[model samples]
Target chain A: MAALRQFLTLNAQILYWTFVAPFAGKPTVRIDAIFQQMVRIGVQAVPMAALTSLSIGLTLAMQGSHELARMGATSYVPDLLSITLLRELAPLLTGVVVIGRSGSAITAELGTMKVSEEIEALEVMSINPIRFLVAPRVIAMIIMLPCLVVFSNYIGFVGGWIICNFALDINTTKYIMRLIESADMMDLISGMTKSFVFGWLISVISCQSGLAVTGGAEGVGRSTTKSVVLCILVMLVVNAILTGMFFIIEGPKG
Target chain B: MSETKRETVIEVRDLVRKFGSRTVLNGISFTVEKGDTMIIMGGSGCGKSTLLRHIIGSLRPTSGSIKIFGEETTTMSPQQMEKLRLRFGMNFQFGALLQSLTVGENVALPLIENSKVDPAIVDLVVKMKLELVGLTGFENLKPAEISGGMRKRVGLARAVALDPELLFSDEPTSGLDPIMTAVIDQLTMDLTQKLHMTAVVVTHDMASAFRIGTKMIVLGAGKRAGMIIAHGTPDDIRNSPDPEVQQFIRGEPDGPVPLKLAPEDYIDRLLGHDRDKGLSY
Candidate 1:
């Protein structure tokens, strides 16, 4: 209950700092700080996100074809791969990648700052740690996670296209047409929405864990491990619920 | 013509702080007047740091009053406390600088964030502050690149960047060589005398504390823990009748100021048993 309260309080604080505080004449986080975090949380994770999505795409294609070929419907690979990547795999896999990469990094960085009294130093300097250190990171994560998901969606499609065009003897035009037809804007929107929530969850969870750190180096290590595990678990559960909701809202689209 | 009163910068009254069942600060009270360098000295874990935190509004007393700049801070909101904090600066024992920012940026932080100082002036002020700490022209180095003494200097530079009316330093001279300790002590004295800034310093270094402190208070240890045993001028403290005060100032190990554990307690603790009830071999 205390943990939940801390999370909610942190969420409220972050929201106020990011949205309401500036209009209240409180200093908003600097653009450069947000950009710095964006580079760290989003730009730097590109290679790992791309690699993860590409591998998932390839494996999905290979496994899907092996099963579908038995049913003599191997040509449907593009439709299935595109739909799965758009509606689920891209956002989910990208979130996991970010949890492993940026989420843990945020926790470790802030936890070290907490143990080292840098956070208190900011406080004594009349600087709000949330406004200066956390809000920018949270805003960056929220903005960047969806962008990575969209990028991952395309990268996954490219990986599947490779398998289909070369391995399955399917033509590029046919594969592209099948993918375009099978996936809708709604699929992209739903997936992006999920990614957006995942972004908020990851950054908040990581920052909360970091800020709550006690002890010293071992405490930072513990918080980082806990942040990653919590992010992954929360993402998975939230993904399942979001997918269910999307299914209900979109009504089993064919 | 009436005489002007020395303005009270920090007035802490009967400040009490407890962690669970252990009382760390017991009815502590003190007042820091403008231009006074108040040294808070104690053995390790004697709650001098805790008292400093209370005075600086970092930690609220369990039950008591802390007034900074004549405003009661015990019940002040965070925003209000922040507003109050702008008038003062604090230096941590370990520098506590943001490792990510360069030394120059660290010094420039409060000025840039709190004030609308022009970027050029901010740069100039950063250089000036660093120079005051005798760390000229090393602005671009990361905190990790700097030595411990240099980091402490940077921390001091950053603390006085805003030219605050009051400064709080926790173990500013700890972990430094004697010459470096004196250098820091001289800087504190300069800030107090030249700038007319009030200071509250928490430290165990007797020489540095005596050198810089116009007034001093020594927190007790062991049985008398968390209570101020002596409070007066540096000379008065030197002639204090309390054995604990005499022992502390003289840096004597054996005295009436008991160690954290007595012999029986230490034996019991090592034997993992209750006091006077440990298993006999």
Candidate 2:
């Protein structure tokens, strides 16, 4: 009961501070720090994101084409691939990729800072960690994740199109034109929404894990892995629930 | 140049810190004078580090007052408090060097962010601080490339880089060899004295504490049945009339604090999840 109380109190503080009044007024954020953090989180995560998106897109196209051909609707593969990539697959895969790749690293970095008392060191140096360490991350994710999701979504579409055209004998131009005609603005919005939330979730959850960090190297490692796995799982579960809600709200089609 | 007479830089009165049901620091009070090395000594889990944190304003006191350089800490706004914190320097128990940053970069960090100090001059200052700690040419090395001792020195360099008027260290000699301990103790003394800085060290190292602490504060239960049982010069503290302190300073290996061989009794206090997690370093 004590532990549970402590957890609730902490979470309450996190919610109030992060969403409500952590700081009463805005402070001028260091542009350089945000850029540096962006490089750390987004730029460094490219290869893994690319690889995951490519595989998922390729597999989806290969399977969707074979399945659609039975219904004599193989030409609808482009529309199918585009809708799935923009509305669901791209955001999910991109988020999980970032969670596995950079989420754990973020935990370890902040965890090491916590364990070595560097967080205290920052306080001694008169640095506001929320503004200094955390704000940069939150700001960077807000700015970069949407862009990264867009990139990933585009790459996924291209990968799927390439597979459909070359491997399954569909015309790439027809695929592109179909995507343009059928994929609505909502498709992009939903993908971007998921990506944004996932980004916020990763940073916030990893930071919380960092705060809970103890021991030395081994402890840091454990926290890092835990933060990543837990963040991914939570993101996926939320993704599932939100998707179901969205499908119900948006209905079958307009 | 003539040396100025040292004055008290830090004063604590009726300081208290509690973690829920358990009170870690209870009504502790002390003063750390300028150019004096004050060591806070206690057994494991006796709140030495907690006391240090309270003193540093990392954790606020539940009640009572703390003044550093004569400024009341708790009254300051967060930004105001942050500005005041810049005047103090501290080396953490685990030597909080950023593993991703090279030693030189780490040492130059405060200068880079807080001030418009030139990078070249900052680099020079870092090298000089590193040399003072006997860690001279390892500037380019990442923290992972160094030994524990070297990491501690790098941390010291970074701590002292800003030329703070007060330096705080937690367990400065905790995991070091005897030789390194001696060197670090000497370095701490030399640096503090030369800089005319006051130092407060939280340590379990009796020899280093005795060797360096101009004044020492012993935190434990039962001597006077209180938190801070002894606070005086090392000589005075050693010869204290209190039996608990006598047992401590003499290293008698038997006291009310126990010798860790109580067996079944120790296991009886096992926190099940913590039991699985084992003892922490």
Candidate 3:
């Protein structure tokens, strides 16, 4: 219950400093730091994200075709593969990967700063620690998570295409047509929306864990582990709720 | 003692802090006058560092008031407190220099963040402060690359970069060799005297405290947690009649501050009679 209150309070502070309070000319946001975080959070994670999405995509295609061929419905392989990857796998898998990589790193970095008294030093220097240390990272996560998801979605589709054309003996034209017809614009938007929320969750939870750290080196390690676990767990729960909400609102047109 | 009338810069009244059920600071009060070096001395866990943190607005007291430059800090908003903090500087025990930034960049941080000074002017000020702390050519190196003594000096340079009205140092000589401790003490004295800054320092080093402190307070332990057992000039502290104060100043092992475990308890444990059944080592 104490942890819940701290999380909510930290999130409220982050929201105000990042969005609402900045308009008052205080300029809580630092563009340079945001840019640096983007490179760290988004650009640097590209290869890993692409590789994971490709592997998942190929496995989904191979498994789907094997089952569908037994039922003599092999033509439905592209449709199943595209819909599953677009509506669920792309965003969820991307979130898990980033949580393991970037979320843990962010927590460790800030936790070390807390242990070293750098955070207190900033405060003593009349600097707002949330604005100076957290805002840029949170903003970068919000902006970059979706961008990475979009890249993952594209790479995942290509991976499916390669598997369907060669291993499944399906024509490229037929696979493209079925995939295009099976998934709609709503599927893409809903997936991207989930990515955005996941990004916010990862950044906020990691920052909170980092700032709440005590002890020393042991505390940092503990906080980093907790950040990754909490991020993944929260993303899973949020993913289910969001998927349901989008299903209700968009009415399952695809 | 001195002919000049001194104005009070910091006035802390009945400050108390409790962590859970354990009270760390208990009704501590003191006043620091402008241009005075007020040394806060205590053995480990005596709340010396905690008191410094409360005065600097890093930790809030459980009860009582702290007026800095005549403004009540306990009731100030974060933004308001930040503005107030602009007039003060704090040097941490471990230097607390940002590992990512170079020594020069670390010193230049306050100038960059608090003002829109020209880049060249910032560089000049950084160079000047580094030189004052005897770290002129070590500016480009990261904190991890420097020695502990050098890191402390860089921290001092950074603390005085803005020429703040008040300066707070926590264990400035804690980890240094005797010579390095003297050098840091000299630098601290120079900065306070040259800049006319009111300073509050927390340390257990009697030698360093005596050399730099114009006035001093020593905290008491146990049931009198965080209470000041002694407050006076260096000479008065040196000649104090209080056993605890004398024991601390003389660096004696056998003092009023009790050892961790009593001899009877140790013998009881050795006899396999556990008084603390819940404790595990």
Candidate 4:
């Protein structure tokens, strides 16, 4: 409960700094800082994200074709793969990958800064540590996570294609057409929305844990671990809630 | 000097800070005047740093009032505090330079962020500040690459980048050798004289404190924790009548400040029966 409150408070502060402060003539974070965070949190995580998505896609295609082929319904493999990847797997897997990669790194970096008094130094310099340090990272994560999900979505389709073309011997044109027809605007929107929320959660939780660190080196390590664990746990729970909501609204996708 | 005409820069009165049930600062009061270098000294955990934090508006007092530049600071909002902080500078115990940024970038941070100065001028000021700290060409180096003493000097350069009217330093000479300590002290003195900057320093180094402090206060520890035991000039502190003040100034281990743990805990810990005991001190 206290963690939830901390999350909300940090998020509110981030919103104020990111969107409202510039209008109020207060110091907002620099664009360069946001760009730098984009490179660190988003750009650097590409390979790991790509690998995770491709592996998931390949496994799903192989498994789906094998299972459906037993019923002589192997043609349904692209439909299954597309809907599963677009509506569920892509965002969820990408979120988990980012949580491990960028999320833990953010927590460790901020935790080290907190213990070493760098945050306090900024505070004493009349610089709001939240505005200067956190807002840019949060904004970058928000922007980057969706981009990653889109990229992962495409890469996941490619993985499915590789299996369909070489191993399954399915017609490439039919497979592509069926996959495209299986997913719609709503599927992409739902996945993008989930990725957005996941990005916010991962960044906020990571920053909160980092800023609240108390001890020295041991404290930073502890908080980094805690942040990652908490991020994964919370993301899973929230993912369920979001999926349920979407399921009810979309009402059992055909 | 007319008392009323002299400007009071920082006025902390009846300030008390308690963490949980343990009181850290008790009814502490002090005033800093313009161009005055005030040194706050005490044993470790005696609330000297806590008092400094309160004065700098980082920590709030449990009770009492703190006024900075005649404005009540304890009640000021974060925005108000930010505005007030622009007028003062604080050098932390560690250099506290952003590890992500280079030393030059660290020094230029305040200048670039707070003002609309040209990038060329910001670089010039950074160079000048670095030169002031005798780190002229070390600007491009990452903070991690610098020595501890060099980092402290860089911290000083960054702290004074804006040429603030007031400066606060926490243990500026703690870990450095004697020569480096003297060098840091000299730089501080130079800034104070050249900029006419009012200064408040928290340190236990009697030599450094006496070298630059125009006024001094020593906080007590143990039974007398959080209370000021001595307040005066260097000569006055040297001639202080209180045994606690004398003991602290003369660096005597056996005095009013107890060096050992309480008798029972000491015996228990020595006997290895304190394994389950959390920190009681």
The number of the candidate with the highest lDDT is 1
Q: What value of lDDT does candidate 1 attain over all alpha carbons?
A: 0.92
Candidates sorted by lDDT, descending order?
1, 4, 3, 2
- Model 2 iRMS: 1.9
Question: Residue by residue across B87-120, what tens digits does model 3's lDDT show?
Answer: 9889998899999889999999989888889999
Cα lDDT computed for each candidate against the true fold: 0.92, 0.80, 0.89, 0.90
Candidate 1 chain A has its poorest 10 consecutive residues by lDDT at: A245-254
What global local distance difference test value does model 4 have?
A: 0.90
lDDT of 1 by residue, B1-281 (tens): 22378888888898899999999999898888899999999899999888888888888788989888889999999989999899998999899999999999999999999999899999999999998778899999999998998998899999999999999999998888888788788989998999889999998888788889999999998888999999999999999999989999999878896546788778777877754565557
* Candidate 4 stretches greater than 4 Å from native: B1-4, B258-281
| Residue range B31-145, candidate 2, lDDT tens digits | 8878899999877788888888877788887888999888898666776787787888888877788776799988888777677788889888988888878888899999989
TM-score of each: 0.96, 0.81, 0.93, 0.95
Top candidate on TM-score is 1
Ten contiguous residues with the weakest lDDT in model 2 chain A: A13-22
Across A88-142, the per-residue lDDT of candidate 1 in tens digits comes to 9998999999999999999999999999999999999999999999999999999
Model 4 chain B poorest ten-residue lDDT run: B272-281
Backbone clash total for model 1 is 0
Question: Which candidate do you rate higher for DockQ, 1 or 2?
Answer: 1
Cα displacement (Å) at residue B140, model 2: 0.8
List iRMS for all predictions: 0.5, 1.9, 1.0, 0.7
Per-residue lDDT of model 3, residues A1-254, tens digit only: 99999989998888888888768877566789899999999999999999999998888888988899999888898888777887799999999888988899999999999999999999999878898889899999999999999999889988889888988777889888998998889888888889999999999899999998999999999999988989999999999999899879978573
Displacement of the residue A18 alpha carbon in candidate 3, Å: 2.3
